[model samples]
Target: MDPSRTLVLNTIIKEKAVFTLFQPIYDLAKRQILGFEALSRGMSGSLLESPDKLFAIASKQERLSELEIICREAAIKQFVSLNLPGKLFLNVSPKALLDPSHPKGETRHLTEVYGLDPKRVVIEVTEQDKVDDANLLLTTITHYRELGFQIAIDDLGAGYSGLRKWSELCPDYVKVDRYFIDHCDQSVVKREFLKSIIELAKATSTQVIAEGIERMEELKLIEQLGIVNAQGFLLAKPTRKPPTELALLKSLHSEVRSSVNQFEQSMAIGWLAKEANAIHECTQCIDAHRLFEQDRKLTSLAVVNDAREPVGLLHRDQLTEVFAAPYGHALFDKKSVIKLMDKQPLVVDEQQELDTVSKQITDHEFDIRRHIIITRDGRYLGLAPLRDILKHITEEKIRHAQHANPLTMLPGNVAINEAIEQRLRSHHDFSLAYIDLNHFKQFNDLYGYASGDSVIKLLAEVTVDVCAQSSSFVGHIGGDDFMVVFDNNDAEVLCHEIITQFELKSKAFFTPEHVSAGGYWATNREGQKQFVPLLTLSIGLVRPDLQHCINSHQVAALATDAKKEAKRYRNSYLFVCNRRKPTVSTVRLENAG
Candidate 1:
């Protein structure tokens, strides 16, 4: 131990001089603040002003346990006064916890002094240094948990003993090291590693918290990995007091969400026509004619200007027809190929989305048979054949139909599950609405299975019409159950619209007499005769944020909860979990009386 640092440590310890700063940790699934990690800083103008230096100096002076206890004492006092929401993560190390010289019950005593429950405290075992004994450390952590403190393995995957410690300690939380999170969005390897860690944590029933996320992209990546908890400067910097209101964090989340949308849209045209073939505009008609003559496989050619911009398209059949005419070859054989080319060829930017290009082609009506020219920044790249586009569209339609529900032709459970998983993986913001038809079975029993099929089909049409204007994925979960996943923020609005549509359409599903009666006679579940109302729609809408959702199953669970809440009413209703707001429209045909 250095004599000068030892003296400084002794002086600071005797004075009990240190303060704590708290950095807020966010729950991505719940989309709220989960807690704060208490970071200790030394008094100003001291040899150990920063945590690193303070801990180093203490270790050098063989007073590591004493310093840790003092910092814990101060942090606990401040944390209790602040009354922060969520867990308080206090830094601890195996060596410090196992220190023979340290007071045994001081940590528990510290919590008791402030009237804080030990469960609210998480003893974060940092992994900056190697542990001498894994078994001893695991025993110590188990003992701490038994004392009611939660266990967290900090700096996971950042040290030599990382995996081993994770296996041995079996902490409730595992904090991913900053190294893996940095630039994770840009590196496939890092993303895969993070995904593995998340999966591992899930398998072990341990939560993974991604730490040191400073970029919105990194934050999005972690969310995409299905990681529920994250802490970093992007969310909030360390403050003497952690933020209780989360207004600033909410605003930043909005900003990052916008960025994520832009990033996803940046690659609109993915590898669409990179392998297209082209020809020079200045080529002689005779030359193109000769090439076409020599190569029977050459069907069409893209004519480019000097700047490599596609100016026209020439088809072998058209050229052959022109040359086959009397005096056509003699007069135009030596002329430029531009004379025989179609000047108004369909041209599209390479950056244009495939769907937009497809729509353009579809709208052209007459040009569906022609090749679409693709360019990069006005420079010709290649031509996309009509056959390829048609094939691509056909394959997409076939795939959609393969996963479609037989009755409504909407996507089925397989597609819905896939879409949810994809959204979770891509970190796209969306809400899932699980729609169930109330009193559907009774209606089917009163009328026939055929009438029930018609009702299901009608509901499907209403759902499609309601979600038509928005970017949504509507699927059928078989029978009376359906799913609609919305990408926009106005899901609550859409939910109400769907309910209105369903209510309006409900009248057409019933007989005139039944409509007048406002219901039909049916046997109740208790073996009593009763009047059953027309089918009503119950929608359980849940936005799949990082906090409350980790996978498709979790999202389905939330949707189930929302659906249960909505089904509580006899009329069409919408129940949003996060908003805790229910919209019940008393406008159902069954309630017309």
Candidate 2:
């Protein structure tokens, strides 16, 4: 990314320079070797072997021909040496492919010398050098595809116009960028973004692979997000020898499914559950008083109507008058619940929006004050005394609030990841959700610098406050968005809760004028009615099994991958679940070096 590195890439391109360094890509589920992505490192020191610098240089300079040839040759040479049944992803400059001379005769030469299958030799049009002419790039890529070479769009999510570029190029494979993977579990915002990417890849029918997975946490996050192809140190460091074990592959596949189960349990969280007919009804005032004795005073009962449908609520005080008049136990027990029931009680579920809870508390409508519990099916199951549930939720809130976002107080990326990690580590089944906001720049441009900060803080506070009682965690990764951890096992209910809360709270961020205008209205530094930008969120959720995981780091990685899918899927959300770990059950995976 520095000027000097750019110079090196430029020099390498002009000079026909390329050196081959191998990075291992593995199949954790199959425990088989996929192959390597041949990387190009320049000769110059200080700037040499630096991927960022090389990319910047290529983008800045127009001389991409020399670089392309070198990269192809290097990949071919390595592929020939291995002579294995795997693909070699060679990074090629899109600019160079525009010229007829570049790919001509190159196909036969690569196969003849390197023994690589034309179909397996993937030409990755990397983001290092973007496509200036969409038509030209597509035509050039099509030409190579005709020659039996596979096409890949590399580092798509990491760039400014990755989606646009992908649309134009239509590559067979998409490699997500690394920055999004880093610290993914902690920042819900990012997980949302990454999950979008995965969905997009699926829709396009393009295989998605993640690169630069350094830590175990990151890998677990990615796997849980439903990504099957992985390349990172957590799987295995790049080396001369290929992987020879099958256990790795099986482990990888299993871990994905198990993680999902944990998330479901967390979402359906309950200390106790039972049938509606388990309790007796009160008829007399004396009977009500007896039911209210000592520790029993706070019980709230579910009252059903004649047809066995739950129609109202029942509490001890409502029947106190009958209890004082006292009758036989038979009279009291046989009485219908309707007489003592408080008809309009608040009903909620395992997946109720945390913010809805917040709103009810804020309004302080005493009759509606009692919290009712519903099954995953939204059926009335039991009642939650506000005092106790709130006490527990308050503790979670204190913990959640204690960890503030670095840029905004909503909650930092670290806190988000930690909550997910804690849940996954406990192996009780939970989800790590990633939330990322899309197209935030226009807001900054119109509202100026000061207002942008307000937008970010507003998002953080709202997301955090909304998830207060369900023990759902909210974390702000950075910049414009936030994340939420929904632990319910019922996928439908969990997704519903988040979407409902986000839609409602988002309204508060916009002004009345902006809301009516069909877009938002923000003042510029000079104070103008700048058009409000499109506001959307991408979400990815992953659940990793702790018992099978190597360590916390692995779970963190899985969370990050889920985030990548969020971004790729067009500002939407994705869910990835793991059944088991893909590698050995070591507590931690250490760097090979």
Candidate 3:
């Protein structure tokens, strides 16, 4: 290090010439600003103007312990001044903690100066170098934790000896570096590494945060991987004064939550019936008989424990036959119903997926328990008979098949409507692209019906392939029209790719003579012969602003309008409606391959 630079660093530390800025960290699941990380900054145009340079110069001069203490004091005072609602993430060095005058009990005392609790402070230890004394560091961390402070290990994968630090210290939170998060969606190795880290963190009872999420795609992928907390510039930038109200935090959280829910629902089973229609285990046989006689539909009753957990099931027919026998009522008129209950009954969890649960029930041929008890978390929720489960499963299969397009076998209007409602109900921003092939009728007329079916099938194949990699839902809306519900913000880019693929494959649909001619001659609707151009696509895009549109119908109406406008032009086009307003942007896709 230079002598002059060392002098400047010492002068700054001695005078406490530094201030702190805060960057917000968001909670993806709760959809709120969880806390702000304190960042240190020096006076502009000085040797230590930026955090990187400041820390670098201090570490070189062997005065980093002094510099960190000064910076922390200023940060704490300012944070108290602002009266921030969430936890404060304060950076600390293991060497600084071991300083003779570091004041082990001062953290609790300092926070109490402005009516602050030490519990709200999270001491984030950054592992720049290996700790010389791991036992001392662990003891110091435990001391702070006992005073109601939290511990976090920053830049886990980017630093040296981070795994050892994590294993020994066992911080409450582990922050994954941006190296793993940057373009995570595109890299299989990064995704797998992050998933394993998350699993390890879960096993250790530690929460993981994906740091440095600057792109929408990165944020979407990280959230999909189930990391519930994150800090990044895409969500919010660091500011001198952190925001008290989390307006942007709420918005991005809704987007992440909606996308995750929609993706999970694509493979979800239909809602199952819970524990309803249950009878107490202590009811007498005569009283149970009277209740059954009152309602003919009550063919069976589930006997539950004091905690409302299912114990057994009682078949009405068997019990009634016993009472109907001569001198049978006198023999067991006052006996408890528990004596007659079926001790071993079919008990299934309510959350079991439709297919798996159905298979379990039908696996045994001789067992004829009339009703299957549905439970939630080991507690009786309701009763579902074999009849109800079979009916529901059958209806779901029939619904799927009936709503599928005959030619492409993709979801049709019925399934499309349900998917739209599901997305809208999640209350997140998403795009619904209404895709239609232009002059499809002309192609069908020029070629044969079989040729037309091939084109439809081709469109379906491309749409499915594009959507298969994403959390998007694709449906064939009959004829040459289709629908796509996008989970990511790359709707336009995906559309362009789809159009390019379709155009490349368009030549194969035409004969060489017709291909050279560009198109075929066809009679117009006015009964006049005119030359029509080759097949093109018209896509109407509508992304409902959840703040304005309350239902899927409103979004569909806007998209339909955009579709009409897109179809006006002869070339392939993408039209997007801004919102409830009529303003739209039309992208022409002429000469696109």
Q: What is the C-alpha lDDT profile of model 2 across 390-484, one tens digit per residue?
A: 56556666766776755665656556556666666565565556566655676566557776676666666655555543445566766664556
lDDT agreement of model 3 with the native: 0.76
Off by over 4 Å in 3: 245-248, 253-398, 406-409, 413-438, 441-477, 481-532, 537-593
Better of 1 and 3 by lDDT: 1
Each model's Cα RMSD: 25.2, 27.5, 14.1
Give the number of the best model, judged by lDDT: 1
Ranking by lDDT: 1, 3, 2
lDDT of 2: 0.60
Candidate 3's residue-wise lDDT over 170-204, tens digit each? 88888898899998999999988888887677556
**Each model's lDDT:** 0.78, 0.60, 0.76
- Candidate 1 similarity to native, TM-score: 0.46
How does residue 405 of candidate 1 score in lDDT?
83
Pull out the clashing pairs in model 1: 28-546, 28-547, 29-546, 29-547, 29-548, 30-547, 30-548
Structural RMSD, model 2? 27.5
The ten-residue window of minimal lDDT in model 3 covers 584-593
